[model samples]
Target: MTRLISALLLFALACASAAVARPNILIIVADDLGWADVGYHGSTIATPNIDRLCREGVELNRHYVSPVCTPTRIGLLTGRYWSRFGNTGPNNERCLPWETETLATALRSRGYDTCITGKWHLGSLPEWGPRQFGFTHSHGSLAGGVNPLNHFYKHGKYMKTWHRNDRLIEEEGHATDLIAREAIRYIRMERDGPFFVYVPFTAVHTPFLEEKRYLEAVKHIPDDRRFFAACLVHLDEKIGEIIKAVDDSGQRDNTLILFFSDNGGQNPSSDDSRRYPDTKPTSKFKGMNTPLRGWKVQTYEGGMRVPAFVNWPGTLKPGRSDALLSVTDWMPTLCALTGFKPTANLKWDGRNIWPMIRDPSKANRDRTLYCKGPGGRTRMVINDGWKLIEIKNGERFELYHLDDDPNEERDLFHSEPDEVDKMKRILARERKADDDARPDPKRKNPSPV
Candidate 1:
């Protein structure tokens, strides 16, 4: 950790001496993408573009996010655990408060053109959409996952979440293609300075729809697996196109491209499928996060631990960081990299991890990573190598030494009573209980669909 701090200081000194050009930022988030789904993670799904990044970029091997969409998005934008806001589930209601500063708004203040071209589940309505909160140009689904071709939000009041800017609109194309093209168009648009593009693709989430080409490509796979594989291929190809666009714009050298999942993949049989109204009736959908226990909405590794990498050709050194990185770290980290001083009251729980990313050994694993499952029903805290998980009303507790039991197979509740007590106390201190969200109906039943 001392080495990491020293590296951070040295980097700061270098930046102070040199006039480094502000780099363009591209953050791509895939919904419900499994930890092992990408080619870099040994999945057979063709993700050559993503795999390329892993080979030449700083792969974040221990990145953690919330178990679901809204919380993860909240943390990424606010640099604070979403639990502090009190809502955990999908947050279908008003999510971010008006006073909150988003990643786009922060970068926009630094003369960067900001745009978002994908899912915006922060608040599931046009009135509470991306334009109202930082993104200068916004398009695609404003709600959670939507019907890929139909562009509907799972048949609800905000079913028509598809839009351009803050107004509803209909565009004829695959959602993935449309999002990638919008991002490409945004990159090509004449702008005065650097840009921040946030593309949160709604693919691999639900309502599993794929075009004929992708379907035919993955035809060898059976049933839902084939459909899921096609979705991955579509997403991967679109990502390749977006990266090409950045390269064509001559921003490749300075652009910082980040790719990660919003949360772990969903296992329909183990998950509350009821929430996914548009999902088709397949025997058992293919979303693999093997060697990890539990699915989304649970305080398990499979739910929060996800795939992430940062590729900046001239800046970050290519390597892997097993450090405890979180979705909340981006805001502060970017602020540090771009020299954006935040307001006094914007208290952030995440620290600048520039040095840590450059070298994995600088990982300060002692920092507590607090996680609150959907509905505040489940809570988790990991400090150092020990972890503690507790069910709110169920009055259940599970403890594990993550260093020795990364799979969380052996519960140390009784074997390591002292460790359990210590972690429980730590969790008590970290749990920020708040109740400002819509009720999560899916928590009671795993297969809602």
Candidate 2:
């Protein structure tokens, strides 16, 4: 009888230790946000709440992601470069194959109640929705970007992509408001264990239709930027509500809230009318990507690098880290920090970045980061301080010492022939590995590779 009591006590203590080790994770992804789009970054946009997170959180100064949404999300969820799937465009159909272990799935296996609120462009149809990818609850658009109020994808069969779980439903609120409401509802609910909530907002991303109140508030802003700034404000306010909910649930201390833009903001283009119909002043709707070269779709610093931060009050020290980081690093880093072991399946391209996060001055100097984007036919390879960008699939190329010229303004291709060859070789090797991992391009037809 004594032995039984002692065993029971030990089991209870072990459970307590496990509970203390696991922290609730809230990852917030903003769509099409720019480098200088927030208050802390000196933008004209008023984003006090997001600015507060930046001030109180550890700024991810050198964070990089895919130049677009679908691929960025694929990397974020799988911890693998999306190019591994032989694709870089918006994944209109089911992206992840069945039985794949996503970040949510891995965390779920480790006893987390996982939920996603907002955009889930990974798969457009209900058959391949978030539930299939391990989210216990999901509410939002399955499309890349939807009309803020209408909640419809481009007029087509997949037009009605907004859903709750696997079922489509008509909701009355604006997209941003609806997403925030669902997130708050999730956070306020009672839970015995850690929760993983991924809030991927489609704000500031599309047709540029602003809510009446938000539009009125930002009336001082000029032209098309008015709607953009209003959208940003709405996004910031919603984020504040989610953070407040976490605080109300008494999970503030143990909750790690990470915020980052999925990619750089869109720039003015000739085809803007076809892409965003409701953009009021479409003439020059280029978002504020000041000081960073290029915009969405290019492999430049502006297209991939973004404003990012992680906040965990007392748990993580708030500061800035210029360490080389990518969306792929999140899964490994989160697993390491929260004591979760993902089921061994596919090998990961990302490594744990907790060390860099802990020591701001420390960097993954030896690491190589590779990216391929469809817009500019952009292919990039970076090792140490050297970066090589092969535009239009090597039709044209540029090499730069990124450590010195963070902006790819000065092309050093002719000056450093050896460095160019080195990076090209590295990109080739990584590309081959990724292509090998992907399904044969000839076999699939829906989303042509």
Deviation from native of the Cα of residue 36 in model 1, angstroms: 1.5
Q: Write candidate 1's Cα lDDT for 1-449 as tens digits.
A: 99999999999988784543578999999998888789888887889999998778999988999989889999898898887777677966767666567788888888889899998888776777788788889999888887777787765688788899879998898889899999999999888799999999998777667878998887767775777789889999999999999998887998999989999988767533344455554325656777787787777999999989999997777889888888889999997787788776577878889889867678787788888888878889899898898887539989988899998999989898889888888887776344443335333322211
lDDT of 2 by residue, 308-395 (tens): 9999898678799988899999988887777776656567888899888777778778999999887438789889899898887778
TM-score of each: 0.91, 0.91
Q: Candidate 2 at 17: error in angstroms?
A: 3.8
Looking at model 1, the pairs that clash are 271-446, 272-446, 272-448, 273-447, 273-448, 273-449, 274-448, 274-449
Give Cα-based local distance difference scores for all models: 0.83, 0.83
Deviation of model 2 at 427, angstroms: 1.1
Model 1 spans > 4 angstroms off: 1-21, 270-279, 432-449
- Which predicted model would earn the best lDDT? 2
lDDT minimum window of 10 residues, candidate 1: 440-449
